[model samples]
Target chain A: MGPITENHLPRGLKLLLILAACRGPEPQIPIDPTRSLTLQTDWKFTSPFSGLFYDYYRNENLIFSGDLRTNLILRVFNHAGDSQYDIPLKAVLDTLEDINSCALFAPDSLFVMEVHSPRYAIVDKQGRVCRVSSLAHALCPEPGNRYEVSGYSNGIASNGRSLFMSAAWWGDCDNTGWDPSISRFQYIQRYHLEGARKCRIAKIKLDPDGSKVHFGGCNILPHLTDVPRFSYSGMERVLLNGKLFLFSPVAPYILQLDTGTLNVVHRIPIDFLNGPAAFFPPPITEENLQNGGDLVSKPSIAGLAYDTSSGYYVVAVLHEVPIDTPEGENHLDRPWSLIVLDQTFTKVAEHIIPGKLYRPNHLLSTTAGVYVHRNIPGRAGVVGPKTFHRIILP
Target chain B: MMRKVIIWSVFAVSCVPGSQDARLSRYLQEQIGLTERQFPKAIVVVSEDGCPHCDRAFADLVRPRTSLRDCLFLIRIDGTTVDLHGFMVETQNVRFDDDRSFKKLAS
Candidate 1:
């Protein structure tokens, strides 16, 4: 065989090298020790659990909260943050079938959230799947989980024109031989949504300097540092002013990334809360795991949104009762707590909500208030079917 | 030459997703039907094992929630090339051309 030369290089291989070089370096978001962005919200919810999925419509003209079931409800909220029935989702998702996953909706989106064979679809106002195009994936390795870590799209959000997606990563290092102390990760590929801005996928490094953070299982690493993930919440992108901000569903900090470059420009760590796993919560039982591998439980900021009307950052905190639960059982079904932070990301108010969050973006912060989904446990009578709770914080 | 073919056949026939977490395989098999019987888009998400964020994300994806099966997203977390591609019997021969975007699942 003739000696291989530059001319013999496959065209695609050459293009790949060019893309890799231009892909740039992995993101390095500095941990600002000076930012004490934590707060103490003594406020507590007094209402019964009512609804879960919350999304604001038309600049807070309408607020909708539903059980994410057959009932897509719209509620009207007064300036006092109280709510009553307004209408239902413009697109009926409850009666809709064929479309899997949550009904991804945003005011600025061109197509309602739909995934199909080629893997892109759009739903109409009538809750019908349209323009179902199954584009073939190039079989590229998912950017975030390089070592074959299992994960999923966390939630869906849009920036007026383009859609932004965030995913969760979980796997074990027991036999992988990777460091069990400090976390190693594959660089997330930045994606360009057909209509959205250039999205640079950054690597997630959650070495939180001895703070207690939760992974899937009870097996806690003594320490973890550098926590940054760029997945946006489904209800609303972690958008403030004009920038795309992101938070690890299980981490204690928020990241602000450059819109064009998708690089971390600034990071505000939620230092007030304890992190790096003050202690590991027990692993989910095989029964509770259902099918996923066992997971460690710990404190986390599941969802965050900047409420325009109230001018507060509504954060959903999922953890075992910070204080002792009345039953004293370390139930994995920790009620999602709602924390309100100011422009500077300081905790201003907090309330213990009554619901179990199944997804990181299950907690939706709207202009009126926040909505959270409560997953039903095995004991139907105890937790009941999944529902959303509309909270009015004082 | 015939021996090589025989060995390859055995390998192909035995190429089951036995290496995958039985729980995850079942969960994906259950949830992934986006259209009339069409499977949702399957993507490989990469993260180091034993990380907290990755752990939480992995659990959230695998856990079955609503009876209302919406858009089923297919996620293959980690495993050997065989484990990643070896889903159904027909997929035993499904090979990704390379690590490039929009890889057509050549069945």
Candidate 2:
């Protein structure tokens, strides 16, 4: 065979070469089944409001409270469910309104997104403010920018140096308020930790007819039925090793984005079992709600996490139950499940949570199992510590 | 006598919402059994489906004046856990949108 040259390469060989050149660095971490640990916390987070974000960092569970109504604080607890420290964030951020969500990254840093403004703050583990930066400048740099950043950011992820957030920029702003239907752009933005803006990496398409399927809302005004109350059109993301994985609420596949160029590398399809009807929630309408429909959301990917030990991607799904079904009484009663996908993006095991005893929004993928919150915080009639149940695949 | 006159004057002026949302005004009149004279100047709606912090922010902004006759707090009760953190009380100004009438009207 002649020495392979760029022009003389076969079609398959050329394609492989191009793919190899474009592919980002993939980190291979050993998965140890024995390293999996079951976690439960005794901290009773009975705050009257809901807006806390949870994550596992360095074998310790971190809970950040950013509800506008409550005192902003970061509560750290050990694996034994004992409180280590509760650091107040209101003073740290010097803002009374509060943050929407937070991402805890390497070297013990927290990237917090604000609820009332287009800004973010970096703070240390001790609740000391490291730097405060403007996302408006990074995102909407155009003069007299029409795209207004919504008050709430859905999810955040960081790869130590760059902070990423699922943010929405709406151009339809008027006296009425910001409209989600006419949202100009939805992006997973990347910003430098020091305050410099990076690239507007991923642009997520807004589903025009998604209002009925996705619980839609405008950030400014409340009490309008046509407007609803919550509208977050961003993807949940996880930055593992060197690759970025994104799970959109409306998309059926998880996208792997190249970290440096911010381009889509691979699309991992999620095969939701149709027979069991697990992790699949059918869409409903306003008429259904008027006719005693209990839930308004379609099946959505609530969160995504990666288990370095097992090389499994755990996707948390919220299932929408029919109104006639008994489980449709409350959102918390709706079924949720953890779908485990192997390194090759093949479905391994799907565990449907047996009862309506846990919150589907919170989940941590571990070697032992996926740890999920037992109950939603601030829920009425729920008492005791914030507990988590491990879902071991059968 | 002076205090009573001032109180009456305030009530008369604040009987109607200064800038009422047309749909909400209609909803209050048609669904909630509220007369035109009973119209509130401001309305705060709370639901579990929405941002909890926004709801609390609204509640905190209106807590000092929650007893005002011109302000109304509508708590959606159906298919939601409407917790106002003790800010809601049994008063004429506060009522549950139990049947989701406002929800239906708004949607």
Candidate 3:
């Protein structure tokens, strides 16, 4: 063939090459919630930063993540997902109390919501514990537990000034808490921080009556002593427009309740909310669920989160995929898939995490990409090292 | 009881297909880079020169099968070493202490 040159190339080929250059940096891949993310472990920190949803971003798309108690350190990341700096907390907050769960209150500080008590602490960037005060009795009131069983408040998220916490595992009528065989009702409480001085707890009546509708707490039964077909069940959430939307790493669904009315406004069913399906008692209520109805075939929803830039929800589902073997037959398989959906709860895109690459806890979408961190907890206040995977999506 | 359990395990292993779907076998072959046609008898964690925990995990999941040289998965326990072979569990009557890994019946 004569010398192969650009001039000899077809008009379409020339145009394609020109357009590719105009597109900077290989047209950044839109994060495929279904695909495995790139694992970045360069940020060096000793303590376990257990806080989920590292979504608070400042200038240069720099996102902030830290815990007033967990790791007692702050980490900043550039839009490129590179760690900028580590801010130590021992210098900031003087209250020796370890935080139960915490979050990035703003660009300048760490918001520590007390683990068992009613105090809220704010540790600023300059290593200063700015505010420490008791929440109104209404917000911090003793949870009667109904069954008077153990009380645990988790899934903490904030909209700058206010804080939201949902009850993770509630006991059944007899206190057989978190038993997969039996279902239990659930609720989340909201508190307006003293930052504005209201510091009062907003009493959410929880639909007040038991008969009409009560959100069910997901399951995590450990006594089975055997492998559970599906063990994806936990409540974690985000607040939008004063409403509390709780999701699970277990259940394949998102629940929206009116904080004002405490009425379950919507139970969005993620039909493809991949997870192990069998052996779970219909979730206290069988209103809306995308479970496959059995254990033989199911999807694994490892984590869920909301992306501000896209106004869409990113759900990490470890789906049981079927692959043909050398025997010429297909067997069901489980792998990670990061799914993105619009605010309207419509499926937007599906990205495969490619093989059993990640075990997701919280999925955070950002200018840099997405962060999947599993809360690998160690014994009493000690947590495992920072093991998180970050990947750019397309 | 032990004899019955072992006998039942052998029969079950021979009779029933593994508990996992084929996608898992593909993951072992593709993601973790395992070889095809290799009958995985046990999963061994090839420790990185001197990683103790990796050694333990390898030992923990290493339930000797009838045929040792037939196949073995050397996973790295120091990092995110997914026991893809762990998912290739057999539906045999053998009690799966944790359902993490199971031995293949002599074929």
Best by lDDT: 2
Candidate 2 deviant stretches above 4 angstroms: A1-68, A79-81, A96-98, A106-108, A124-130, A141-154, A169-232, A240-242, A275-297, A323-332, A366-369, A376-383, B1-54, B61-107
> What TM-score do all the candidates reach, one by one?
0.40, 0.55, 0.45
Candidate 2: DockQ? 0.03
Residues A1-394 of candidate 3 have per-residue lDDT tens digits of: 7899999989999999999888865323233444433223322222123333333443334444454423456676554446666667775346735445555546666655554555656667676777666442333233432211101223355555444554322223244334454333222111101011111122222111211112223222322213322232234556543456665443446667666554557776665543331234232223323342343333545556655555667766656543322111111124456677788877777776543233454455554445665333212111233444554432
Global lDDT of model 3: 0.43
lDDT of 1 by residue, A1-394 (tens): 9998868899999888888889967532211222211111111111111112223443542222222222332333432234533334335333232222332334211122222221334544344544444322211233422121111333333343333443222222233244455432322111101101212232221121311111111111111221222222111235554556665433345666665555567666653334431122223232433322222244655566565556666666666454444221334366545667787767777655444433324544544445444443322312132244444444
Report DockQ per prediction, comma-separated.
Answer: 0.02, 0.03, 0.04
Instruction: List candidate 3 stretches off by more than 4 Å.
Output: A1-62, A67-72, A82-85, A91-94, A139-155, A168-234, A239-244, A258-263, A273-279, A282-300, A306-311, A320-334, A348-352, A367-394, B1-107
TM-score-wise, the better of 1 and 3 is: 3
Give the alpha carbon lDDT tens digit for every residue of B43-94 in model 2. 6654555555444444455556666777676665222222345443446777
Superposition error at A341 for model 1 (Å): 1.8
Summarize candidate 2's per-residue lDDT along A1-394 as a digit string, tens digits.
8886888878899999899999986532122233333222222332212122334345433433232223355555444344556555665547424556565554356655666565556677777886766544334434322233332323455444554444444432232253455532221111111111112233221222220111111121111113221222344566654567766554566778776555667777765545221222122333433332232444566666666556777777767556454323445556666678787878888766543666566655433345666654332323234555654443
Give the interface RMSD of candidate 2: 8.5
Best prediction by TM-score: 2
